[model samples]
Target chain A: MKRLIFCLAVLVLALAARPAPLFAQAGGPLRLEITEGVIEPMPIAVAPFLSGTANAGELAARISAVVVADLAGSGLFRAIPAEAQIAQVTSFDAPVRFADWKAINAQALVTGTVERTGADRVAVSFRLFDVFAGAPLGDGMRFEASEASWRRLAHKVADTVYQRLTGEPGYFDSRIAFVSETGPKNARRKRLALMDQDGANLRYLTGDMSIVLAPRFSPDGRQILYTSYESGLPRAYLLDLETLGQRPIDNQAGVATFAPRFSPDGLQVVYSLERGGNTDIHITSLVTGQTQRLTETPAIETAPDFSPDGRQIVFESDRSGTQQIYVMPAAGGPAQRISAGQGRYGTPVWSPRGDRIAFTKQQAGRFHIGVMRTDGTGERLLTASFLDEGPSWAPNGRLLIFTRVSQGEAGAPSLYTVDVTGRNLRAIATPDFASDPTWSPLLP
Target chain B: MPIRRSILTVAMLGLLAACGQNAPYGNTPPPGFGGGVPTDAVDVSVFGAGVTDTVLFPVDTWELTDAATATLTAQAAWFTRNPQATAVIEGHADERGTREYNIGLSARRANSVVEFLVLNGVAPSRLTTIPYGKDRPLEICSDEACYARNRRAVTVVAGSVDLGS
Candidate 1:
């Protein structure tokens, strides 16, 4: 029996080392497995965090609400309403009443506490329990941050709970950079904007003086790369978030450059340059300012994305007389077409896990947001609409957000998110029309 | 001489079409034609009157059709008549395509017009190009007619042009 248990432990470790599949459905008392079919949301109870200090009651409640909202919004967990709880968590260290939670059909229970740790500083701690097993699922943890960042603390706590249950990293603590649009479709004004993943902390990084498109976050999330028409022509610009300063990525006269994305290392930028009406992909070193042409075909080549390991680049091209997806070495070489199905494809974005590529396809008078394996197999269309394009992946590679424009005169573009399995389709709330959403890496 | 005669014939047809329709291109009448005082600087209205200032393209293509070529031929003649004027060609695409790809396609459309004008003896130094993609559409409908009107290149005569020069 001891040898058998040792073998099982080794097998679990080996599976963990491999890139996790679509869902981690490990056998556990509180497992919420998601298969190809309908997923029954797991019932979980998020007890309001206890306030350690007299003045922390309201903040503590708000934090708990955010945690509950995050889990419920994911569609994998069904948060039991606070009113439905049989008992309240009044203390942080007290043992959970497993029988009461089990009676309410809550497979998992979450409890936490909030306290004013210092001047303008707050501390949050949380613990997760398997109600059926009558034991804590993971060790309790605490996080400290500025009091103004209470929502982030809540996300971090929820992320910890999610990781412990799902065996996957949570994307709650990430941010998104997108374009906020206003005015008439004929003369719309666009500005770059950033917000937390849940649409909180909305802030505009650029004024509406110039049209901005496709704001992409660097791997470090401290800087943004986007296309702007400020110079009487479309060009790519790099904006530093800390200083709110921007500089053109390439400003050569008579050349229109746009669609810029940073390499995984954030040390190089890959973008398209239009010279005399020809668009091709080019990469420039940030440190050396040296630019190299990655593609030299007469056909249009744009929207280049680097793999997570920065070994290969996947981009869209029209060399085959129709738009299609192609993958090539990062150092520049012959590319192999990876999209073989009917219709046209563009805006190909490689998945963060390096297993799939998300793209926009147009066929038979309709547009679709789809994904395929790097080898071009397993093609699945996640969305079909009058106009849907530009798929940006979450840091965990489990979800995608793209733009969906309605049809006709009153049509406007909006941001929508969907799980990789094409489930849990939800629209992200923005103050104005939004598009080209790029998710930032998980916050440091 | 044959090109001049054809230009005159098309100019007459354009005037008839402008008078018989309610702005078929969806463009508001130029200042001088709409009862507003015309500025001394060359504008699209005066330069395009009786000669269309825009050329339309087929879907997802920048190749100049025969009608588009004829329109450019007329535009080149206008430039010759107003040698001191400069123009900025604006390229646009329909709403059916992606934003960045449309930008590229429109740029090609603008370049095609610029190349046509240069070949017709217009000075290359007097022209510039701006690809608007689908950001600006004259028609708001989602039908093919609206899309056809949106996919175009327009020669917007700049205010800096000195007619007296």
Candidate 2:
């Protein structure tokens, strides 16, 4: 009996001496899947970066604030206010007090260190931790860039942290192209404006010499396709971002073309062309300067958008006596009407994931932003307003940015964003009235 | 309501002028004469002389109405009178549809006017169509009357107008 007991004890000790199974440890990494969609933002705490250099303290605070703002603005992560922090982090290398964070209901924590490397260069290093799991989510990453690019560095940090937590890529580093409006409603001066996703770095791509509308970015973010009324006729123009050079899109002498979007491959553009009292969808190859009619109907057909695979096209048409969504072959074929709702539907944009389509719906004298499945089922209205139109999806297909026009003479159009789940509706800050926002793909 | 309001204003002004000229004092309008003003009291000159500059259309349609055809016929005659001038037909839509789709609809509406003018013996070269969609509106109000005023095609006679703004 004694010998058997001794053997059993030795076996137990041997098993205990070995490391716990990969996921059987007291605290292992936690993976959060945003598949079903998260309505409540996970509470996160961002500790001020540790810095010991000339003006490093101020810069560090600013960097951390930006990081917090980026994550909070996403609607997937909520930053716990500094007053809610239970413990302060003074050293980047210090072990995280998971217990303290857990007490404040912080599901995630971020700690970082910032240092001045050169006269005008700084380095930011950060690590994200899952408080409940008591383990670092991903390896720490350090980004070095000029001081002038501090905001971008901050966005990069937030993006990395977001990707680690959400299991999806981040769009914090992306840009938006929109129409900036000023003056009164009757004589509004609208200019094409470009800015960061967070509304930073406001730049006007066109002066107020003429009205511009519907600015769309190429997949590579190197060019923009927009409609200009410079010639007193709405025509699409392709503007190269690098040179600010633009040329008129190819069209027949009497045909007016507008509502342009780049194909997934960025080698072609799909737009609407109006000729002889009839409007239809057309696809134009950017390389060969060739154009093909995609839709040929007496009813108005416009707002053509290509599927991510560039195999199909979805657009808005009024063939049935009311506006509705339609899908057709990319090369042109008989279109299948998708939207079956009572009211008018338009601005059908295929989601990046290709599983859903977002659109602007006008029903019973109310405007709404809604989404539906590819085959037109599972319709969901995400927002309602006096005037809400022009939905542009984030690259991840998780969020949408659109325009909302207020009511009355003081009513002006502005940009607003909402998650695909129809939560976190917030107005995007702009210098003035902004509309027709389109999101660029993730930065290279 | 907006159309009625404009007509009433014009009628009231006409009544005041008649009183000033004949009675030289405030006087009640004669029973039949007060409401005798024609429903079409809206003077064609309000839309610009010789050219009925504005032709309205029904919602989400580019089909020419009988009234619209009448207006376009008058416009064609005006273009015939003014040979040196070129006509730019500006098509507009009410702010009830999507911007891009409205652009398409406006184009169709403008083209309809162009076709009607051509049918009426107006040279195609003398008329060019421009689809402003809902970007420019004759009325910015959201009511039905305002929307009706907005869904229109206006023919502007430009005498060497520089359209390249």
By lDDT, the best candidate is 1
Error of 2 at A28 (Å): 6.1
lDDT of 1 by residue, A1-444 (tens): 999999999988876664422222346545555544436677899988899887999999999999999998887789999999988888888778899999998878999899998999999998998887888887899999999899999999988888877777889999999999897776677899999999999999998866789989999999999998877788899999999999988757878899999999999999999987789999998888899999999888889999999999999888898888999999999999999899999999999988999999999999999999999999999999999999999988888999999998888999999989899999999999998899999998
True contacts kept of each: 0.59, 0.56
lDDT of 1 by residue, B1-165 (tens): 556544544553454344342111223342224333232223355455566778999999999999999989988987887675577788899999988888888899999999999999899999888787887787789999999999999886642332331
lDDT of 2 by residue, B1-165 (tens): 556555555664565454332211001222223455432332244334554667899988888999998888877776665554466677889888789888888888888998998888878888888787887766667778988988988775543221111
Error (Å) of candidate 1 at residue B86 is 2.0
Clashing pairs in 2: none
lDDT (10s digit) by residue, model 2, range A220-314: 99899999887556789999988889987775776788999999999999998888768888888999999888887888889989999999999
Name the runs in model 2 displaced over 4 angstroms: A1-28, A35-37, B1-51, B160-165
Best by TM-score: 1
- Cα RMSD, each candidate: 8.5, 13.1
lDDT of model 1, residue A443: 96
For each of the candidates, give the backbone clash count. 0, 0
DockQ of 1: 0.33
Docking quality of model 1: it rates as acceptable
